[model samples]
Target: MAIQTAAKATIYRMVMPDHICPYGLKAVDLLKRNGFEVDDRWLETREETDAFKAKHNIETTPQTFIRGERIGGYDDLRLHLGKRVRDPEATSYRPVVAVFAVAALLALATSWAATGSLLTIAAGEWFIAFSMCTLALLKLQDVESFSTMFLNYDVLARRFVPYSYVYPFGELVAGVLMVAGTFMWLSIPVALFIGSIGAASVFKAVYIDRRELKCACVGGNSNVPLGFVSLTENLMMVGMAVWMLVKPMGVGVGH
Candidate 1:
């Protein structure tokens, strides 16, 4: 897309019915800050989103077609700023990073809630870990289904071996171990591992699915864009994981 040299630029945003106004608001804010007039009425409807998709051979929300050229999503918007717009910020990550840090903190707090019952916690652990791993594997096909299934089992069964268990009980133990381990000397490695898992999951979802899907990673409340949003989430997870593996803190330590 050609750079907008005039004092103002015209951009249209399509908001999903349930969508909050992040992309739309951010675009308007940035453009106005950089000397552009954003017409609030220019916001598009679902029909407009679909129509533009057909018209310009594109598909997605917050789609920026600057000067009749499709600039794609938020990432593309950043790219436009970097390549064309003057005084581009070195990088736009404050919002992304802040959101991620908050999520990681939340995850750490909830990890222990599962321990209310061995059976109950075990089930929850299996559900979340396998769910995340499967989604990642499905999106990326990182591992064959057979292997992925086995790994998922390994995650919950091996580390936490229950006496009357199915699959590798050790894995279930490890989940708790790693969560605890974050506070121990091994915190860094554990954090990296956990972060890697999250990163891979998010990467597949973003790069492959194109961030079209609302993330259920933490939950619907935290649903956000792909790319930087996902990356920040993983990074935050990695930070918490490292803290766990290194210091091995338990519940109630301001985790």
Candidate 2:
């Protein structure tokens, strides 16, 4: 019986005196990681690179081939290997999903460590608080930009411009206070106010006005769509606020 060898791929990439194609290096790394035997070819000069491009009728370097068939550039190669290719302008929920997912994990982990239980009322509260803090941090990264994007849809923020600038801080304060469980009087009200305004604004913009926009829930520069995820965030805050309001203020303090 003959022994089988790894799959083979051929890549032609630029490695000039002043510039090396980063995609070329990335392509090679991907091939190696996925158990492909790569034949790396370099175009060491601009003339050589241009000639190769003309011959192949391609516009970019880091051109790849599989089994002697031309497979286009780095992104194309990624598709061939069943990898996700990100579109820069496309709307997505990945950032919001990631924030919520990590927050839930942290809450669960803390619950288990502190009380030897993962699914407690405290854990649920912590999850919302953590999500609020993380989302606020993202907005605070570029408050100016976040506020600008925020005013596009937020009814209260547009009416009171300063509120746009202060929104992230309010969220952060509410979240921190909720976690500490010492200032429920302040935190619960802040959470209710902002969350109510946010939910109303999002509903009017997306449902009533039928407008298309990006969400500032994660950040201003984020490509997340202004829809379900945005509404969910505000609703979560409101729900947490109401829950804490009904429960004892000292219930989860320092837990």
Candidate 3:
């Protein structure tokens, strides 16, 4: 529609000497983007802002008015415009689910190319190893963030601190060695050490202490829940480590 024909919106926001309300700018931009001509009103002082809030019976700045009707603040403006917004605190397993799903497909492809079969012991082995590498990649993206989250529930990380920084590198190294099927001595120890500590920490935090927390399995910023899934990841590492360690003997085993 033409600019003159667009709907009109009036927004009252705070733009004081030392502080500007970010949501006010967002509300104005949102209105303009959605075929509305915005009248951006600024309260330049604390007294003016407080008076506006008191008069309108609202608690926040960036209060929007559409056709003389109150439309609330930024988040409320989005809802008014029918925009889909995510709930930041809602639990989600999306990250781990995507990583594991892609890892499974990669393992199947690798197995088909190597042995002309998808359902094989090597495929299963590759799946676990690929998952480790994929999960490690997420952590490696932001080591500081990953370490901060790791310290929340990790036994060694909480005490040693530096261990949190070392954990992702350890996982990556072990994963690469497992894939190559070489350097078993190095890979086995790294996996077992980290895995045992992780499993114990998770069990203590969730099962014993009954604390509800987010899992750092995928990454530091992930919303994946800390419970069975996290425990399973650590257990998988331990299982892979033990199996690879014993495969050399006549009993026959593999990652």
**128-240: candidate 2 lDDT, tens digit per residue:** 99999999999999999999999999999998999999999999999999888767789999999999999999999999999999999998899999998899999999999
Query: Model 3, residue 232: displacement in angstroms?
Result: 0.7
Each prediction's number of clashing residue pairs: 38, 0, 0
Give stretches of model 1 more than 4 Å off: 1-6, 15-21, 40-44, 83-255
Write model 3 residue lDDT over 88-205, tens digit each, in one string: 9889888888988998999899888877888877777788899999999999999988998888899889999999999989999998888887788999999999999999999999
Error of 1 at 227 (Å): 24
Clashes of 1: 38
TM-score of each: 0.33, 0.84, 0.68
Error of 2 at 67 (Å): 5.2
Ranking by TM-score: 2, 3, 1
Q: Model 1: how far is 62 from its true place, Å?
A: 1.5
Among all candidates shown, the one with the greatest lDDT = 2
Pick the TM-score winner.
2
Model 2 lDDT vs. the true structure? 0.93
